[model samples]
Structures are given as structure tokens and as C-alpha cells.
Target: MNNYNHILAKSVENGATTLESHLESVADFAVVAARYAGMDTEVALQGALLHDIGKASVVFQKRLRSKPSPLELPFRHEIASLFFLKLVSPDLQPFMIDMIVAHHKSIYKDVSGTGIIDLENEYEEDILQFHLSDFSLWASEAIGILAELKFPGVTHETVITEEDAREAYYFALDHCRKRQKGWSQWKGLLMGADHIASAVGDFKEKVPALFADPDVSFYNRKGELYPLSLIDSDGTKKHTFVKAPTGAGKTDFLIKRCRGRIFYTLPFQASINAMYERILHDLGDHVEDIRLLHSISQLLIGEERITEKVIQDKFGASIKVLTPHQLASIAFGIRGYESVLFDLQGCDIILDEIHTYSDIMQAIVLKMIEVLNHVGCRIHVGTATIPSALEKEILEILGKEQVQYVQLSDEVLTLFNRHEIYKAEAFTDLLPVLQQAVEQEKKILIVCNRVANAQVIFEQIEELYPKTKKMLIHSRFKRGDRNRLEKELKNEYNVSPYACIVVATQVVEVSLDISFDLMITETAPIDALIQRFGRINRKRTAETIGKYKPIYIIAPPQKDPDCLPYNPKILRDSFKVLPDGGELLRETELQSLINQVYPKVEMLNIDLDAVFVDGKWRLKELWHLPKSALIEKLDIDSVVCITQEDDESGKYREADKEERILMEIPVRYSSLRWKRLKQLDIGAHPFVVPDIAYSSERGLDLAKTGAENYDTNYQIW
Candidate 1:
């Protein structure tokens, strides 16, 4: 150990501690392995140590300087190192050659981009040229440096020749070309050693048990979720319908089956937060078993050091709650999917509010279900409203023979009766509706489709209800501000009769716990409307100050010759069949009404093969551009980091910021500061392969965790 420390210290002292340090360390690892292989330990160490001596050469050093000369084009570091090692240690030449050629992923032809590789690729012709020009320069320089430094391994005769060096270079190149792996045998040997070395001391320190088994109590035999209280029997292997209305403890029903390694996929952020809080509160001391895995909650728990690498190397949580976007990433096969799949595999998944996914999003969700099911995961579809088209799609993927549907019974639906339907010619008529609601002293949740429209209705309501207390919520508001408003709304336990109204965009549709007497909503998809209904008269048997007010579905204009209807014609037809001003308590009636509308529409599939036929997108045929530019144009900016402190401001401000490409964002340095930002895993980690946190100017900024500021002055098209 003391000798190892001395060697390590000497290497660092000799300026082998930067990015290139990984190279030298890996070489040492190769030596140890060679010793274990019973192949001349002393000779192997000598060769391995000097193998990267060429890395310290001026040619290689110049490329890694903080600022390279403007006139000098960046030279490949591998060529110089290969030249030096061949001349100095002919006995260990094979191992040194392997390390030099395959270190950079691009140069390794056979295993190029495969992530893991066994051998190195070698090319005959390129090696001849590289040996003649590059190796000669490297060998001469290396010998001179050794002599000047008075190194003990100095050799008088240069064993390298034009033909001998050419063969070695070609052998290395061909080895890489045919290896079909990311790292060469020599390189992996080195990397494994470094990993072991870095973790050696820490092994002695007591570490927390990072992983916990799934809480499988929620699931039953043969892998099916138990139905809600409304059902007389447990859920079976069939397309199950869980239709217990809001406040009927549907979450508990889903939780019972999602026992081990749970993944709660919510439709909205508000709902994700609500579920996270419920799990935290209900689980009590076991709350740590569950991890809130959305962008927002990730930000709140950002500094908790939960990463895919951390999670894989150290088991993190039993349950993870995330949004559809996070779940969608798995199907897309994005960066974190491998780790996510590893952690979530064989776990019980609860897909809450499956009804909220849009057509395009729903297609992806179905694909995700297909993949998750293939991996042996048990899933539960939990929603107040599940249309036949969506249910059929899920059933087809999950297998109609295997799925079970548990819906609300007629008795429960009858007891939870609330809401009257209202029609309006224009949004201006909402004024009279607001007056009636306020006069009755009822809490109202106004839902709008568009942010601009929501703002307009909120302004009108504030002007009319100036004396009455009211609040407005939307996605545009910072998360902190939204939470503040939610807190105020939840203050129902206060002494006085708290009279407050909330006007919000579609954000209010899910996860909010507050119950309202009335809901005035804009025309939207049936699922959205059903979700809006969940907000009003939400709790069990909460009596209205007067009779429970009817929900007003503010329809778009009757005759819009100028524009196509926001509510599709098919949906409008479905609404026409249902009678107005009638009770809508029966589950059969509600399901019948929904089945007629929201039929699945086939989507135009993207030709990914056409786009990537020759390792490039057919941008010219599709978007009239090159593939490189098309790849650069993806917008990842909408994701916000919900950290305790803003990167620039350095305070715990609950605000939403846009996510950036790996090169643009910075990792957080302060542990406390990092935990506040959301979406740290949007890209790859710098230390991990396929470095996600890359910056062209600085190489890879492993220390950054904040999103880049968007140019507010620039118009987004």
C-alpha cells in the first residue's frame, strides 16, 4: 500500500493528474493484470509506465493546453504516444500499441460507438503513413526527454524502423477496426484499475445502503392490481376498469399492487407533486423508500445525489414517481433509459391518469407500455375516465386476455352525484356565471385551454369579483409562486370561512386536492373535461353551501364560419347525444358517452430509417436542410430545474428555467445549491461515457448543473 501510494504520488507530482491522467492510471492497471497473467511483471510495469510517457510529449501536450496556438491545428494525441512507446519498450510494444490506438472512441473502427469493445481496430495503409511521419517524430522526442530527465529505463539504440513501425501501426489500426467494441482490451484493463483505485479508500468508510427492495404489498398473485373499494372482488388479469370517482381513494387502490419498485406516472406536474406528497405523508418513516422522479421533484431533491450512475452503482430508491415525459424518454431510448430500465425492471408501475396523454404522446406511451411489459414489469392503469379507444390500445398492447378493468359501481356513482351542464355562445357570458358562483359563496375552479385565454378570463373575473377573494394559477408562473397559491388554497383549516376562487389554465386539471363548488371550463378533449370534473366537488360527501352547483362547460361559438371548432366535430356530435340539465351519475352512461367520442386516430409515422439511411437524416427531402443542422435544432429548453437556489442569484427561488443541450448547461458545485435545480439528468453526466455535459470551449463542464438563460428578446417561432 505504501509503495502504491508513493507511485501514485510520484505520477501526480510529475503532472500526470489532468485529463491525460486517466491514460497513465489505466497503463498501471494493465501492468497489474499482466502480472496476474504471469507474463513478466517487471517488464510489463516498465512498458506500461512508459507507454503513456509519449503522452507527456510536447506534441500531445500542446493539444491539451488551456489555450492552443491559433495557427496550430489540433494534432491527434494517440499518434505521438504510439511512436514513443514502440521505440522505448519493444517487449511491451503490443500492450502499449493497443492502449494508444483505441483510447479515443472515434479511432476504434470496429467497436466505434458500440460503447464497449474488446480489441483494437488496425488498418494497414494508414499505419504505414502514420509510422513514417508521426512515429519518427514521437520516438526521437521521447528518447531525448528521457535522456535529459536521466530516466533509468533509457536505451541507446532505437529498436523502431520504418517497416517494423509500419506493421505495428497497421496491426493496432486493424485490431480496432475489427474489434467491434468501444474500448480496447488494454484500455479496459487500465480503466478498471483506475475505478478500483479511486474507490479503494472509500470502501473502508461506512456507506449508506443505497437500494431497497420493492414494497410488493400493493400487488397480488399472478401480477394484477387489486380494484378500488367500489369493486366487490380484486382485479384480475383482464382490461380492468377502475372508475371510482375523485376522492374515492383510487391512489390507494393502485398503490396496493405497485408494492415493489413502484413507478407512479402522472399526467400533470401538479398531480405528480400531489402523489409525491401523499406517498411522503402516508409512508411516514418509509417515505425515503419512494423517490419523486419528475423534473420538478428532481429539482427539489436535486442535491440528494441520486443519479443513474449512483443508482446503478448504489441502489437508490424502491419507488420513483415521474411524469409522462420521463417515462417517454425510456421508449425514445434516450440517455437515462438504461439506468431507468435497470432500476424500474420487474417493478410494479402505476400509470395514473393515463387519459391525459395527447394523441402523439399516447402513441409513445403505448410503445413504452409494450417495452416495459416485455421487461417483466406489472402495470396498473389508474384513471377516473378511460375512453374505449385508449383502453383498447392499452388492452391490445397489454393483451386483452391478460388485462382486467375495474370501474366504479353504479351505487358509488349515484352517491357521488354533482355538477350541472351549461352552454354558452361566447366566453363573455362567463361574467353572469361568475356572479352566480360568488353570490352563492362557492369556490370556483375555472379551466381554460390556452394561457392567453385563461389570463383574459382571470382579468375579467378579478374586475367583477373585486370584493371577493380570488387567485389565479398557471404553468407560466414560477413553481414557487404556484406552490404559494396552492398553499393558500389548501388553507381550508383556517378559522374563518375562507372564500377564494382560482382561475387557471389546463394546469389545474390534475393533482390539485382542493374541491370547488363549481367549475367553468373551456371546450377541450373528453379526457381533459373529465379531469376538470375531478377538481370540482372532489371530496366524498362535501355538502355545498346551497345545492351542489352544476359545472358549466363553456362551449365555443355555435356558428364559427371563420374557424374550425376547437372541440372536434366528432366530439361535438358525442356531446349532442347526451341530454342537457340531467343527472349523469351512472358509470355505464358516462362510459357509453366517452366511448362514442375520442376514437383513436391513426398518426403519420416518421420514417426514421429514411432519415438515417446513411447515418444521417434525410433533411433535404423532409425539411430542406442538412442532417447536422436538423440534429442541432431540437428544442430541449422547456424543461426547468427546480433547485433550492438559482445558479446566478444564489437563493432558493422557486422558478422554472429552460433546459439546455449538455454543452450549454453547467453542473452545480455546491451540494445544497445543486439540489434546488430540476432536470439534472436531461443529458449525460460528464464522467460517464458519451459525456452529456460537454462544452466545446471548455471541453466538458462536469461541474455545471444550471440551465442557460434564454434570450427573452428573441422571438420563438
Candidate 2:
């Protein structure tokens, strides 16, 4: 252990990180995490101690010390670590090997038949020569250090010969082929510990403890009657399912059920943002423990406030509000997934609004659930409405007896009955009704199925009522502008006592807390329609209870094929089950209506059998699949379409590449549209959209024509 201080693991401009210090720090962090996750602490410590043993190579040391390193290709330190596995007991070898080789990258990719193990002819000699150096001193120092640290099963020291290195390499390849099934908790712990130690520059900084006791005084202070508050908080320790109406204190109930760190997942970005703020407001003093994570989290956090602590909070927050898509990486074994698994182990996760997903996404979600279950996560799901078939499938995947199901009472549902259903033929037919509501000074909300339809409706409404306060929102607006508009909509329209109109897309369905006096929406699935209905008369006070607001459902598009975005059969069934004129659409009947519309789970023809083979999950093939494939399968794209005005701005020019990309809007773009934009000569910014095609008022004009006539260099200033 005394001699271990002489060897260096990393070199910076001022000083070096000694091998003994790095190893001890990593082992300390890994042991704590392993104990928390109920893993073998000794095995975790051994793996962490040997994780970077290869960095002691003379060639690697020279490269690290050079001012401007001449080495074109970096050495694989993980591969070098395998040379000394023989010093550990045989029983711990496989676990240690799995953690060593697969810690940084996928083992299947680096050690397969056609992978790095099959070195090219030109590099074969270099690699062989790299490993021929005498590493006996480093080996003896590491073994001595481990003995002092009291690490179990690592007392002996072995001279790493060339043959021993080759044997260990082959053994790792064979282990990856035959023994590796799912992600190893041992690997997750080691990777997590190493990352934290590297980032904090020391292992002494303890992992932040999770927020176990959240403040729920906000709900108690309101003195509001919500069925969820009546339930005991102790029930949250088990796997549970809850069925309750929207605005029925579902968020509070979900939080009360969490006994440790909370992962609250919603379906839409808009919803996640709303939930993040809601939790922050509710938690009050504990606000620092909550974080909002997504692809554009920096944008959501605003550019000026993004510090090192804010970035680190993504993986360490006690309460994380995000989309389930972020967790999909673990199921697919994408890069950096081990750290994610480490964060999720033994955490309490709340899956809110789970029914609003496609068939492919549902399958991926199921796979995630299975993995989370095995990792000791306590899963709690709460939804406004879910079909029986889908519920059955969820319970089967989770094991029926393992989860406790809870449903709200009919009396409480009756209290939430606030909408009166009415059917309309088209937006044209509802013009008179909207004009009348405008005259009565009532707040009106119009939801369209498509962005184009919303734009057209907004234009017509503006022309008809030239003096009314109106706004349009959808998925295509720039992130900054969209966030500003959402805040304005919530503050201005929600609190105003006068008449106003807002036209939007499905983005308004899930977590927005605004209320309207009247709602007009295009026909959608029954569950979705129920969510939409909740936006009207949402408070359900004594005065608003008997004064039921109207929700007009427009007929389906005639020429469109069975509702392009949603299933045609489900839409038709939803329309059939609608209450007649003057009939109250009671919230109690929503569950039955949803079941009627979707009697069976809609299983898409996506092959996921490869993910599960012989009743065991294997991530070998999934790890190799490109991330773009997963994004395409999810029917989402993180596109950054820069408007011509943005290209000329001093702020945009001064911003770094990542900051500029964060400013881009994340919306679904067709291949043809992306290709067309790519072909245009927009100077340095290849993603510039034509001036005539994008604006803050009307986002992303997909149907804009005569693009060749517009000035491509137009600037906002």
C-alpha cells in the first residue's frame, strides 16, 4: 500500500491522481451504494478497485503526462484491467470481470467475434507490445492496498504474464456469450461510484440522501375534499395501482405513496413541466431536491441559471419529474444506462397518465416495468382512465398478487361530474355557439386534432372577433416562446374574470391546471376525451357543480382514414358512447366508456421477442441498435429548426453549439421536411427554416408555398 502512492491514474495541468487514492475512493462509494441496493458489498468493492488498473501502463502514463498528447488513439484501460483477475478468487472472477469489461461500454460490442478483440492487422503488434511490460510492482501495490482496506477475497498477488492476459481476455468473451443475461446490479454500482468520484474529484462526498418525508401541508391547508387524502400513506410501500379522476388530488396521493426518492413520469413535455412546477410549489422548502429532466432540460431551466449543480441534479435529485422515455435507455441498454439503473434501484416511481401512449411505446414500457421490478423498485401507477384489457396486461406483467389495486368510490366520482356533452358537425357549425359564448363573456377553449386545423381555426376566429384576446399553442413553437405562452395562458386566462379564447392541440390534455367555461374538441379516444373534459368546470365547487359547462365534440374528418393519429374504431366507439343532448356526462361512467372503446389491447406488429429469449431478457442485440432507431420507433424526434432570424442574432452567434441546439424546438418533423431544410444554403446554420415558414404567432408553417421567392437572409431585428 505504501508503494501504491507512486503510481498515477490521471494527470492534469497542475497535479496527478494517484492510483491508490482513486481506487480507495471508488471502492468507498461503490460499497455504500451496494449496501443500499442490497448487493454483495465485497464484490462491488473488488470490481471498483480493479476498474482502472490498466491506466498504470507506461504508455498510458506517458500519454497522460504529455502537454499535447501525440497518441491518435486512446488506450483501452478496461481491457488492460483484465490482466490481473487471476489474483481474485475464482468465485468472484465472473462478477469482477462483468463489472470491469462492461462498465464503460457494452461488453457485447467490445468483445464479440467481430469487435475490438479481433484487432486489425496493423494494430495487433502495438496491442501485444503494450501488454508485455512488467506490471508486477503495480500489482503488488494494489494487492497490499486492498489487504489494508480489508477488501474480502483479494489477499493474493499474481504476476500477470502474457499468457495469463490472453486467457483472461478469452474468458471475458466466453462469459459475455454464455452467462450475461440482463444488466448486472454489480456493474451499475461500480459505474455509478466511479462517475461520482470522477465528477466530485473525491470519494469523500457522500451520495445525497433521498427525500423520504415530503411536506404535504399544502394539501392539508387547502381543506379541500379529495378522496386520495383519505388513504393511508403506509400503502405506498407496496406496488399499487390507483384509479381516480383528474384534479382529484392524484399528484398529492402519488407523492404520499413514495417512501424514498420519487420518480414521477408523465407522457408529454408540457405535462412534465407543469408537474415539475406543481411539485416545487407544493414541496416549498424542499424545492431544491426536485428536478426536471428531459432532452431540453437546460432550455427548461433557462440559459442563465444552468450551473454545474443544476446539471448534476439530473441524476441526483430526490424528486425527478420527467417523461418515461428517459428511462427507456435502461431497457435498451444504451450508453450510460448503468448510472440510470443505479439511480432507480429501490426508488419509488409513479407512472401518471399511463394510457396515453402508442402500442410500441406500451411494449417498451412493459419491458421497463419488468426490469424495474427485478431491480427492487416500488412501482405506483395512477391514471384517470384505463381499459380493462390494458389493466389486465399491466397486472399480469407485474404479477397480480404482487400489486394492490385501489379505485375511487362512486360517490366521489359523482362529485366530479361537471361536464354536459354535446355533439357538433364541424368547426363552422360551432361558430354561432362560440359567438354567443363570447357575448356572454365566457372563457372558451378549442382543441384541434392537428396543428394545421388549430391554425386555420385561430385565423377564422380572429377574423370573426377582431377585438377578442386569443392565443394559439401547439408542438411546433420554439421552446422559449412556447414556455412563455404557457405561463401567460395559465396566469392570464386562468385568473381573468372576462371572456377570452385559446386554441391548442392535444398538448392541453394532461397536466395543465387551467379551466374553461366551455370546451370544443375534435373526436378522440374515450380516455383522451375524458381528460379533455376535465379542463372545463375543473374546480367543481358548489356553485360550479350544478352549473355544468358544455363540451362539444366535433365529428371526425370525412376524408381522413380512420383518424390518422388515433385508431378509427376507437374514435367511432367513443362517439357512439357519448351522452345525448341535455344529458350530464358523469365522471363515474368514464371507466366503462373507456372499456367499451378499447375492449382489447391494441398490439402493433412490432417484434420484441428478440428482447426476451428463453424466458430470460437479453440486451445483447438491443445494446448494438442505434439510438435513432429507438427515437423513430417512439414516433418522436428532437429536431432543432433554426429560423432565418436566429442565424443573424448576436446572442445566437455567441452561444455555444450545445446552447444553440437547446434553443431549437423539439417537434416531430417528416423525413421530407428535414431533407428539404438540409438542402437549403443557410450559411453556418444548416437547420435554418425559411422566414415565411416560421413565426412566434404561427409556428412552423408546413404548408407555406413560394419559399423560393422569400428572402432567405431575413432577420428579426
Best by lDDT: 2
Candidate that would win on TM-score: 2
Q: What lDDT score is found at residue 60 in candidate 2? A: 63
Q: What is the C-alpha lDDT of each candidate?
A: 0.50, 0.71
Instruction: Summarize candidate 2's per-residue lDDT along 605-666 as a digit string, tens digits.
Output: 33353344334666652133335365466667544666666665644566664556445655
Query: Candidate 1: how large is its RMSD?
Result: 11.8
- Find the 10 residues in a row with the least total lDDT in model 1: 1-10
Residue 576, candidate 1: C-alpha displacement in angstroms? 3.3
Estimated TM-score per prediction?
0.62, 0.83
What's the CA RMSD for each of the models? 11.8, 5.3
* Residue 293, candidate 1: alpha-carbon lDDT: 58
lDDT (0-100) at residue 638 of candidate 1? 41
lDDT of 1 by residue, 1-717 (tens): 001111121133233343223334444444555453345555444444454454544445544444667664334445545545444445666665554443333342222322112222233344335324555545554554444333345654434555665565555554444543111334433333434333323231232233455444422222112225434334555223455666666677677644356677887766777777777666745544566654445333334433321222222356677776665534543333333454555677788777776655666677667667766778788777777767777777777666666665675465555655666656677677777767777777778775556666766776777887777666544444555555565665211254557777766777668677777777666656777877776654334412345677666435543213244664465445444563453444677767767555553233341222222222221011112221122221243333222222422222222121111222223322332223333232211112222222112222332333222221120
